[model samples]
Target: MSNLTIVLIILVIYMALMVLIGLQGRKHSSNMQDFLTAGKQGTLLLVTGSYMGSHIGNGIVVGGAEYGATYGIGGMWYGVGAAISFYLFAIFMARVVYRNNYVTLSDLLEQRYGDKMTSIAVALLNAVSNIAVMAGQIMAGERLFQYIGLNPLAGAIATTTIVIIYSSLSGLWGVMMTDVIQVTVIVISVIATMIFIATQGGFSIMAQNLPATSFEMIPFDGETFIMMLGPTALFGLVSSTGFQRTVSCKKEKTAILAPVLGASLILLFVPLPVMIGMYGKALWPDAASGTIIFQVLFEAMPPLLAGLLIASICAAVMSTSDGILVTVTANIVSDIYHKHINPDADEKSLGRLSRISSVVIGIFALIIALQFSSLISLLSLSYTLITAGGLVMIVGAIFWKKATRQGALASFIAGVACVVINKMGVSLPYASVFPLIPSFLAYVIVSLMTQNKNAAAA
Candidate 1:
């Protein structure tokens, strides 16, 4: 059989297996508590695995090559940002979030300010961010399909459908369990490529072929590095999936260690794809930026192995999508629908809504994937909006007891407004993070005023 045929066969089998696993996860997911977080029973291995799955997503495994191909060594920013996020969260957030017994970020923020409307607003914004991230993940399957001579749209539809089905059926436990399998495939793909490259002369040959500038950590400028890194760092801080991973852990030590260990693994694993993409640039010189690494890997692997790797790429990318999908679903069901829209929603009704929301969110994300083909760029836009508008509020909620609902709400408005304005026509350094200035100021100023007013009234 042709390689494409073999890959098609393997993909069919692999995707079926994923759906089966989700079915198994459904057994554990009887209600929102189990569906959303596996009932806080995640062990260290599962949490860390899911964290790795969520963070690595399309941003690194596939998009990393595209980024590294375009930015050279500077592509290291994503991994650096992730490592920083994990370390910071471990020290500042892990325990706090766990102690409070929060499910979504809105829950965490709501306690600080005591506003149901603010909770609803947070849920909506998070929905936007989560859906955008899901779109980025879905694009990975489009990339793989394009590589294999299939219709890109078909690939996108297929991937989105599978994720919606599986994530809806399985929930958090299923996501973590399937994550273990997907992560294994990622390791094999990376190690195999590294070994293949080493056999063919390794880093020495690659360095000689590439320009010296490719070795620099900051390949372009400080601003671009910050632009690339800052959004990820802030998103890491505020990410719903990251929050889910933390709160999923039952033990205090496990919660802390999972993200830390996962970050360490990410730090080590991220460089391989950057180097691989660089090597692709050194050789092909004119290959597409977003697909250089995949091409390189496919060229090195046998037909069967290549098929497996491609399937895994789909799994890896969708692995990220399901988490984002689940986050948005939770926002709709737990944060908005159950909490605000229908306070009387029983666990059974909420459970049905959760599944339906997953389907709706996945469809919306699929529409986005159809419009944009740049995986990393799409992800950047998602993070940019969230970082600009939501990051400040989350930080204030955690640190400043005086952070009132008015301040949190203002920060969301100003930060999001600034991002839209910046995107329209403004050209600025660190465009992704630039809006944070207005966001932070609004959050702090409005907060102080509101705090004083409330204090006086008391």
Candidate 2:
């Protein structure tokens, strides 16, 4: 059989399994709470699987490989930063959010800020960020299909349909179950590739063919390390998807431990892509960025193995995309529609709305994906917006009892303004850090100024 035919068959079988899993998960989801959080009954294994699955998306694979091509071994720093941030989140953030029984970050903001407006603002910002991130995933899948000589538009539509079908059917339950399978496939693909590469004259060839810098832990210049570490760290900590995974856990300990476990697993896989990219660099020194991983996979492996690797990449993109879509839908249904539009809506009504919102949001994200061609850019923009607009407020509200509503509003506005201005070519030093400073200052200054009024009202 032709390679294309083999890949199509594998994808068909894989998607069929996903549909079956979704049907099974539907039994567990009967209400908004069940849909959004899987009834907050996830064990550590489920939480860890879902958390890691949602994170190791197409952006990480392609972007990490690109970084490896450019910066060599130090390209691993971004993933390292992400893992560190996940660990920090587990230590400082997860337990607090879980103990509060908050199903969404907006729910926690509502409780701390004592205002529906704050929740509404957060929900909108988070929805935009999630949609943008989902668009990146769709674009990633499209690129995979394009690499295999298929129309990218068709690939995107197929990706969107599968995600929406499974996600709408069972919500978090379906997402988590499929995530476990996706992560497993991802590991298998990586391992098989590693073995194949090793048997074919491994590190020795890479060492001889590549520059010394390619093996360095940190580049001699240090600029790449500095730039990668900070934003990625912040992105890891403030990720809306990460927050949802933690809240989905059945117990506080599970929530606290899952991210750490997931981060460790991520760290383990970080070297595989970097090595692949390095090898690609050794072979094609002038190849365009982001093509290294795919080029290496197709060139180095047999037809069936290459097909499995392709499916693994699709698994990565779909797993993350589905999680983002479901969370965005939940925010719309729980925070906006039910909370504001019809406060008295029953669980059954809300559940129906959640499924409908998933399809709508998936379509909107597909449109955005078709408009954008760069996965890394879209993913980075989403992370930047989420960090600037929402992270400070979330952190402050959790740890500071005196963090007032006015302060949060000011912080969010200042941060978003800074990001907008920077994006307009204003050129700021440490662009990511620039917005955060003003955001923190605005929160502190506003909260202190409003202390007397708040106390008097109390």
Candidate 3:
């Protein structure tokens, strides 16, 4: 059989397994709460795997690889930023998330501000960010399809369809079960790929062919590193998917510990793909940066291993995609419909709505993937938006009891406005991150001014 044929066969089998797991997971997710939050009883293995899986999509795959191809080992700074966020989250917000029986981060906003506008704003902004991140994951799948000699559009469509199917069928249960398998497959593939490269002289060969700068841990200027790292670090504070995963665990300790473990694993795994990209740079210096990882995969591994890795990558990418879909669905069904329209809806009705919402969100994500071909570009924008007001408000909600609804509203407005204004005419270095300054100032200044407004109630 042709190499492409073999890869396709493996991919098909892997997809079939994912669907079957989703079907089986349906038994566990009979109700809205179970579907949305996995009944808030997820085991450490399952929760840790899900946490890691959801964080390791196009950001660490295609984006990281392209970074490596461009800046060598410095590409890992992106993943490093993510790791920093996870650790920071564990230290700062784990206790707060675990103590509260919240299904989403917006719920936290509601508790702190007690305003429907704040809650809805949080949910909607997060949903928008999730859509962009999901697009990045689908883009990764699209690239993998291109590598297999298939139509990239078809690959994007098929991948989205499959994720929506399984995700809508079983919700977070299916996502977590499949996530464990996907994480296992991905970890193994990464390790095996590294081993295969080692046998071919690995970094020694890479060093000989590439510049000495290729080996530098952080290849770029400090400003570039901060631009790459800041949003990702703050992202863990406001991420809807991360919030859902945090609440899904069986215990507070599990909720706190899982992200720590996941973050450490991510820190370790970040460099593997960077090295792979460097190897590809050594092999094909002129190839497109985004295509370098797959080029290295096909050239370095045996056909069977390559095929398995390809299938694993597809599943791994979808792990995050499906989680984002589920989070958005939660916002639709619980935060909007249930909260406003019919608070007494049964599990069956909510379940139906959840499925429909996930599919709808997936469709939107597919559209976004088509509009933005660059994984990091789409991701950077999403992360920037999430961190702008989202990060500042989350911090205030957690630490500053004096923070008021009006302050949150003002913070969000100023933060989002800064981003828009920056996009229009600003010419600063790392412009994407500059909005946070105004966001934080708005939060603190407005909250202090508005404290007496809440004092009447107190």
Candidate 4:
């Protein structure tokens, strides 16, 4: 069969499986909670699948490939950062938040901050950030199609439509189950590629073929190196849309186990891109770095194998896209609709709203993706906002009892203000310099000051 035919067949099979899973999940999804949280019955394996699968999107594949081409195998720093964040999640934040049994992170934010306005602000921030992240995934998928001689816009629409249909119909249960299958295929494809490259030349030949700087882990100059490494490592721990993973878990154990194992697998899988990047640099150094992985696969493999690699990228994009869609809908349904619009709404009504919200947000995101020229710019801006605001409040709620409502509110405001300023091209030493440190410090200071009042009163 032709490579394009093979690719079509693989996608058809993948979509068929997704639809089947969505249908089956419908049996268990009787209420908003069931639809959005799998009735809180997620196992450790499912949790791991959902967390890792949703995270391993076009960002890692496209951006990591680009980094690998420029920075050599040391580009594994992305996964390294993610793995450390997962470890942090397990020991510190995972169980604490999940055990509280909150349906959304905004739930906790509202509870701790005692400010309805602050909670609503967070929900809006999360929704906007999610759209930006989804846009990046669509952009990457478009680039993938361009590699295979298809129109990029058509590719984005096709991928986005498939994801929205499944997620909007079946919600988190559908997304999680499909994620298991998608992540497994991705793991298999990446591991097999890594093994092939290693067998072909091992590391020595690749090192000789590439620039010396590419092989060095610490090749970047001092200031720029710190700028890159610090954010990459801690970003996951601080500002991730982690509520989806936590809420889907059957219990706290699933939450902790999934992130740990999922992160470990991510680290193990990094060699795939690094190897592909090195091989592509050796053969097609002049190609756009983002296109290196696809070019290398087509050059070094048979048509069938190349199709399989394309399928893996498809799996990664779909898995991540569905998770973001579900989470964004969850926040809208659980945090806003039920809380503000109709506090007495029935389960059936809320479930219907959840489905509708998913479709609406997914379509909106698809529109943005089609219109935007710079995917990375959108992704970075989203992360900067989240890390500045949501990350501090969410993390503080888990670890600090003294973290009062006022404190979280102030810190959240600080983080958000910094992000806006940075977006406007104004540099602030603390806020725009990087999100984590200022946000972290602001949360601590505000929390402590608020606590002092209680102490004085007592």
RMSD of candidates 1 onward, in order:
1.7, 2.1, 1.6, 2.9
Clashes of 2: 0
CA lDDT of each candidate?
0.81, 0.79, 0.82, 0.71
Clash pairs detected, candidate 4: 113-405
Off by over 4 Å in 2: 220-227, 371-373
Q: After superposition, how far is residue 172 of candidate 4 from its true place, in Å?
A: 1.5
Per-residue lDDT over 155-212 for candidate 2, one digit per residue giving the tens place of the 0 to 100 score: 8898998788778776787888878887888778878887888898867778888889
Question: Which order, best to worst by lDDT?
Answer: 3, 1, 2, 4
As for lDDT, the candidate ahead, 3 or 4, is: 3
Local accuracy of candidate 3 as per-residue lDDT tens digits, 1-458: 87777887998998888888888877767787787787776888998888778766567866788888888888888898888888888899888887887678778988889888988887888888888888888888788778767898998898899788778777787888888898888778888988989998977888888887887877788777777888888788887877788888888989899889989999989888778888888888898888788887777678888888778878878767888888888887789789977999988888778777877888899998988767776887888988886888888898987889988988898888877787788665676688888888888898899888789887
Candidate 1 vs candidate 3: which has greater lDDT?
3
TM-score of each: 0.96, 0.94, 0.96, 0.90
* Local distance difference test, candidate 1: 0.81
At residue 353, give the lDDT of candidate 2.
Answer: 79
Cα-based lDDT at residue 169, candidate 1: 79
Top model by lDDT, which number?
3
How well does candidate 1 score on lDDT at residue 206?
A: 70
